[model samples]
Target chain A: MSLGEFDLIARHFTRPARRSPLGVGDDCALIAPAPGMQLAVSSDMLVEGRHFLSTVAPERLGHKALAVNLSDLAACGAKPLAYTLALALPRADDTFLAGLARGLHALADRHDLDLVGGDTTAGPLNLCLTIFGEVPTGAALLRSGARPGDELWVSHPLGEDEPGWLGDARLALEVFRGTPGLRVPGEAFDHLRLAMECPEPRVALGLALRGVASSAIDVSDGLLGDLQHVLRRSGPDGRPLGVVLDADALPRSPLMRAQTAALQHECLLAGGDDYELLFTAAPADHGAVRAAGQRSATGVRCIGRITAESGTTVHDRHGHRVATPWASFDHFRS
Target chain B: MSLGEFDLIARHFTRPARRSPLGVGDDCALIAPAPGMQLAVSSDMLVEGRHFLSTVAPERLGHKALAVNLSDLAACGAKPLAYTLALALPRADDTFLAGLARGLHALADRHDLDLVGGDTTAGPLNLCLTIFGEVPTGAALLRSGARPGDELWVSHPLGEDEPGWLGDARLALEVFRGTPGLRVPGEAFDHLRLAMECPEPRVALGLALRGVASSAIDVSDGLLGDLQHVLRRSGPDGRPLGVVLDADALPRSPLMRAQTAALQHECLLAGGDDYELLFTAAPADHGAVRAAGQRSATGVRCIGRITAESGTTVHDRHGHRVATPWASFDHFRS
Candidate 1:
């Protein structure tokens, strides 16, 4: 059924806010951070074709929209609280709205996040979600806290895999684009599609790493590119820090390893939309890191160490310097 | 000059946040409410063609974008704090970015609002801003608090006017659309354009009315339509509250009064984007309300009163019921 803007919001977006004093109906949503807690806010906008394929299911699009924003919170080690979604649609279709709401609310319920307030209008399809979370004062993870001696860690394996295994979202995009001579097994195809459309933000792992990890960031715009942000931000005084990422030490699934060396390198280093936490901690906290990983039920792998140098360098299994060429996804660039 | 996505953000949107612990270039921006305060949050999205004409200046577009979001905060009697802006641009034009940033920052600086965090991407031109403000615990004005016998008020006079006088934004829209037989004086055209593009949010007025006003809302939607929101929400038990708005008391300018009766009715009653505070207060608080208006340097006019009835009705100067044929602007319906 066709619905007016207000009816659409009342039917699909409005929910009783448990943590907020008010939600959905008012001009502004009221929220107060718990005593001694700070609110962590992040915003992300996704446009059709630019961020997701039009062929992607509306349910998965909803999931990914919130997933990407939650990933930002996960990077900061903040607990999900509430979010405002501003959506622009070409037309308000009943089936699309239902599936989108179902997917959005499902993930929100899992994290106890309330859909607090937002704006809806008719325009080109765009989804902008601004999320709010909370963390104890002075305890939030930041990109600039990693020191020179900290060891780099990733929360998950970083490549294509079988149906039940974690893989890269870029694989799905490549398949959708019909990349030349790229034939994937049916099971692997399913795994890659899941990776692209339904990434799981590592919120639990982020929380677990709060005290143990020196600093953290989520892997979105490729590992190397995002890692550069942390490295650049964490620079000490005038001397910038660097990393010695061992190419072989970068975790990859067996299916990914079976691919050509170039494809493997591209997927492992430059694949975007992983939503895994890449973090750093001192060598002394190795046991604590492992314990935290176990507590959160997430895998942790050390691939490098923060160094006193000023640029990132990758070394292969044979201790040979690798030629790195793939750059991370930039919205304005091809 | 060509800019990548990150460069565009760093150049145009990045600023040192005054109140926030963290700002742009982080996974999340951190903010905390002061003791005994609650955070008020609101979001608004603007799209090209639908929200504004392509001929509108980019600077004014930026101002209007943030103005609408701040109007939400004002309606809730919240003090502005900071905001996140998520923008989708068709291209990274240096001139456009500079103008947009200038206009955005000008309003932000005037309000003492920090540019906390946001997202930017390449897509159809769209702007979404999520703003944060603070109010004393339990003192926020709500749409549901207007009681029967309270007087309905508006912050400013409605309808169009000549140059140097307040006017309705809809007049500018009508002029842009080239409506038949509509001739606006050149000087009046300038004022109407300003009314449409650079709406000033009544933040000071809202702050002054915190304790005096029972309920408040901004006139983004038409007066009659938005009043219905307050009336419906303020229902006592199962019965809804209503308003007896005097059409003649709507406070039209001389230019507006010269218009045809039908045109006057449309502009004063159903024109959107006025961004004026429409509020209610008890008859006992009349003196206090006047003091608030004086304190904030805003015009406050009483145009109607709340009643125990179930729906709104309009009365002309002769005390005869008038047919209200105009509906407010609904995004999906029209």
Candidate 2:
């Protein structure tokens, strides 16, 4: 069916704003934040090829688009309220749009988030979602609040070994699935693939960790790179603090184990597209952190500690260096 | 300087979040709106080639990217609070970044809007801005509040004749100026070109008319197409409100006189990208509307009325038929 811009929005994007004062069709969405609450806002843009493979399922793309922004809110320990989409598409293909809308609605509905307002324009496929959330005033976990000696906890393990955590690897599956008569362990990669493509945002976990975790950041640009933000912001005594990741303590992924240790370390340390939450908490609050994890129904594991020293490193339990760390993914690394 | 994604954001996008509780470095920005207010949010995306030409200045491109979103806030009578920019660039070119940042900051500073948070990544240049504003709960101007007896008021006159209102004409100047050494009325087109390129959102005017106007929307799409939204939403009883446009009353521009009458009308009624405000008010509130225009220092014109009848029509002052209108600007209209 042919759809005009208005009809496209009405049919695929518009939803009654049950939680907001006004929604979809208006000039602006009216959101009434509860008293004593602060609004948490963040935006993420996913471009075709750069962000995902062209053959990836549209539903998964939609889920990941919103999921990435929600991950930001989660890192701040905010409860999702609503979100707006700014979509630029090459064309309005009905099947693609249907799958995309279904994926977005499935996740958004699960979080009770209203699709507020957005713009749809003609261009190469670029999807940007700006999500709105709320947290108790002054209670958001920021990257600046960690101190030296704080326990660094990850909401889950990182890398491809853990199919549950490899949402981005789903694209790899899509690429390899189309390989010319290629033979590979398909079933082994299935879970990891889906995990990479549709990684769940740790919203509930983030909310539960509030007032518990001293600082937090979502792992978008690999673990080490993202943690650098926390270290930079929460440096001890005006000095940039380094992080110490114990090689053995690192989350073990079966897919990662299949690779050489160096590659595994690289993937775990600097491979981005991981939506897991890496946070800090006082050693004394370990029990509380575990409890919060249970309450939120998400896993939590102590992976390392924030150090007073500058720079980041990976070491065995006995303190032998496994490898040197380099800069994580940079848009303009050169 | 060879910049990384982090440096690009730090150098160009990063600024102290004076108004926001938390800003750029965090997962999400935290904003505390004043009590008794609702947050009004909108997002817009501009893509190169689709939204602008390769010759367009990066400064102007950046300005329009934010300007379009701000126009939506004005239509809702919301006070600018903050905005998040999700920028995707093919490469990190320093000069382009500088110009874009300068343009964004200039307008943002004027509006007192803080660049609270955003994501910067590598891709073909696509800029998405999501603006946040505040209005007293229940006091927001909506497209659905116009009554049959309401007098239709536009923030300015419509059509190509009105250079004061043709923001899209800014590109036309660029077209003719770049015409392989062809000469045209350069100075005569300056004001119109700049006006179209950098539209001043009717923020003050919309705010002034908040309690005064019954229904409102910013004319991003052409006049007729946008008014259709009002008519659809604010109809009387069960029928859509009919709108009558007086051809003679449309604000005129000298540049428009160069175009044929049909082209002039087409540009006036269906040309998109005019960032003026279109609103309706009770006949008794005419004085308030006049006050708003004076306060905002922008032209105000009474061009029509909302009727109990259905559909829209354009006619001359003597009731002679002018033309029929269709959909405004659809991404997939073709």
By lDDT, the best candidate is 1
Docking class of 1: medium
Proportion of native contacts kept per candidate: 0.86, 0.85
Candidate 2 lDDT tens digits, A173-246: 44355744322256766666666688789999999999999999998877776777788778755567778888
| Model 1, span B1-334: residue lDDT tens | 1336468667888888998888887899999889999999999999999888788788898899999999999999999999999999988887888889999999999999999988888899999999999999999999989999999999873233322122357767777878876657767777667878889898999999999999999988778777878887888764668789888888666666666767777877888788889999999999999999999877888999999876777888899987767653233221
Off by over 4 Å in 1: A1-5, A157-167, A328-334, B1-3, B157-167, B328-334
Model 2, range B154-193, lDDT digits (tens) per residue? Answer: 7764344445564245335444447343223667666666
Least accurate 10 contiguous residues by lDDT in model 2 chain A: A325-334
Work out how many backbone clashes candidate 1 has: 0
DockQ of each: 0.62, 0.59
